[model samples]
Target: MTHPEAHKSHRAGWLRAAVLGANDGIVSTASLIIGIATASATQEYILLAGIAGLVAGAMSMAAGEYVSVSSQADTENADLAIEKKALENDFESELDELTEIYQTRGLESGLAKQVAQQLMAHDALGAHAKDELGITDTTSAKPLQAAFYSAVTFTIGAALPLSLAWAIPGHLLVISVAVSSLFFLALLGGIAAKIGGASITAGALRVTVWGALAMSITAVVGNFFGVATQ
Candidate 1:
């Protein structure tokens, strides 16, 4: 019997975008609602603010993720281009570079050179790209994919608190949204950590703490502003 290993590193690109989007959506919208509700705003006004935050946050996440990932993609492309030219101009030097990389990774010199020769014979540019530049297909940047994930996850995350705000009433709205959003944040963190092969408890605690702090600070600010206005 042969065993195949499964790795989670391939999930890096989309997972990062999704986690960030969902986390931002929950924290920002929840904080916004909690702040407004704490200030004694009308339910309608609070819900309206939540909706606006959700829409704005989703768009911002999409655009920001797209642009940021696009930049990384551009950088990777530029590096690949330079590597390609270097290979075209100095095949021997590039071959030696790849061999040296494998040697440093613990292969004997002769074995390293042979391995490099075989890899380069099959695909010189690919060998150099993977070994020297650290660019692999699994880890390559995808702007559109990142943007889509971020936008969708953010909308879903923001809806949680917004719906809670709508369903709950009075001063209780603030407390309810705060508590529920923290739970959502913790759940999200744990899920992300689990998928990424990290400690779920640590992840959950990390996000929960930050979310609680965010809501608390927003509540204080809202209370202050509400008092000052009155």
Candidate 2:
């Protein structure tokens, strides 16, 4: 009999970082452009602001992802090191620990011990790491990968709004950016959710609604400042 295919939990690491970075890039850059346009800023100034936001946002995403994921990787490595030492110092207890874990997962006591013995004989540290500590190969953290994906995706997403700002006239810039940003946000949300096996409509609405609110607030603030300065 054929076994069922495994789920895509392995993609969680980079997919989540990339999607978040892209969404932030689109929303934040578009909002910045819309805000500046609403404030009666010149087209040149608006485009410059968008470019600045894109560059800053991408760099921030990269740095943030790298630091956070690196911390996680460090912790995982420390835990594995501790577990390895434990296995060397107390092999019997480690084997019993694995056996208990299997038993908790519904294996019979005798069978659990037998299975644990076999696994320990084959790869003791691997068995402990996977079952006891929940650190598998797929879930192992990679800081560089996360950082690269986040920065690249952020740049790509930010470029969309910047391109529109460059092409659209000043008079219509705010509305055009607001609408287009929402569309892109919704699209990205749907695509990311689909890849992550979540509800598409929910994801789309979630990002679009928040994106609209963000743009709306920024526009209002810009208009208020514009009028005050005038």
Candidate 3:
């Protein structure tokens, strides 16, 4: 008996949402804390802002992912419904369409027709959904799953910087939170990339660069405002 090969494609749906959520959580919360601190806000105010950012960001990410993925799922279901109706109305035509699809993918016409016939007989809608509409169990949209992952991961990620801010006080709070947040971001990127079978270094660098930029810009704005107010 041959062992089945492991694949990462199945992780595509949740992984996208998780990585996006975590990255946003860390970057946004940390940036908010850093900006507040740079503006000479008290430690209490900085921590408060971090908490608010965490809660708001997590909810925003969850809502955004849910709505977007739900739209995709709706479109997919609509397509499948249309395909089902066509299959019901003209089974022979649908069979011929599948056969032509297989033929275009390199199978000989006769073999393609035979394969299509067998597949349609086994599970007509499934065969059409996969081959014709390009929707598979692994690749299909999942709004609830996406929303849950995003919300949970974002909360976890945002908690890191918030905890650091709470623990570290005084002038060092800004530097400590900034540095630690970058490390967290890099670690998250590497883990996500490794799991998805991509380049770890590239992924880590990609998130780190953007995180740093966001923090920098926010800091500048905060400092400008602080100076203007004074």
lDDT of each: 0.94, 0.92, 0.94
Error of 2 at 72 (Å): 0.4
Backbone clash count, each prediction separately:
0, 0, 0
Q: Give the CA lDDT, 0 to 100, for residue 226 in model 1.
A: 86
- Give TM-scores for every candidate, taking all chains together and pairing residue i with residue i: 0.98, 0.97, 0.98
> Candidate 3 on 43-141: residue-level lDDT in tens?
999988999999999999999999999999999999999999999999999999999999999999999999999999999999999999999999999
As a whole number from 0 to 100, the lDDT of residue 138 in candidate 3 is 95
Look at candidate 2 and tell me the lDDT of residue 133.
87
Q: Please identify which of the two predictions, 2 or 3, would achieve the higher lDDT against the true structure.
A: 3
Error of 2 at 61 (Å): 0.4
Per-residue lDDT of 1-230 in model 1, one digit per residue for the tens? 97978789999999999999999999999999988887878999999999999999999999999999999999999999999999899999998999899999999999999999999999998998888989999999999999999999999999999999999988688878888999999999999999999999999999999999999999999999888888
What value does the lDDT take at residue 20 in candidate 2?
A: 88
Local accuracy of candidate 2 as per-residue lDDT tens digits, 1-230? 99988687988998989998999999899889988888889999998889999999999999999999999999999999999999889999998999999999999999999999999999999999899889998998999999999999999999998999999975887888888989999999999989988999999999999999999999999999988888
Models ranked on TM-score: 1, 3, 2
Error of 1 at 21 (Å): 0.6
Please identify model 3 stretches exceeding 4 Å from their true place: none
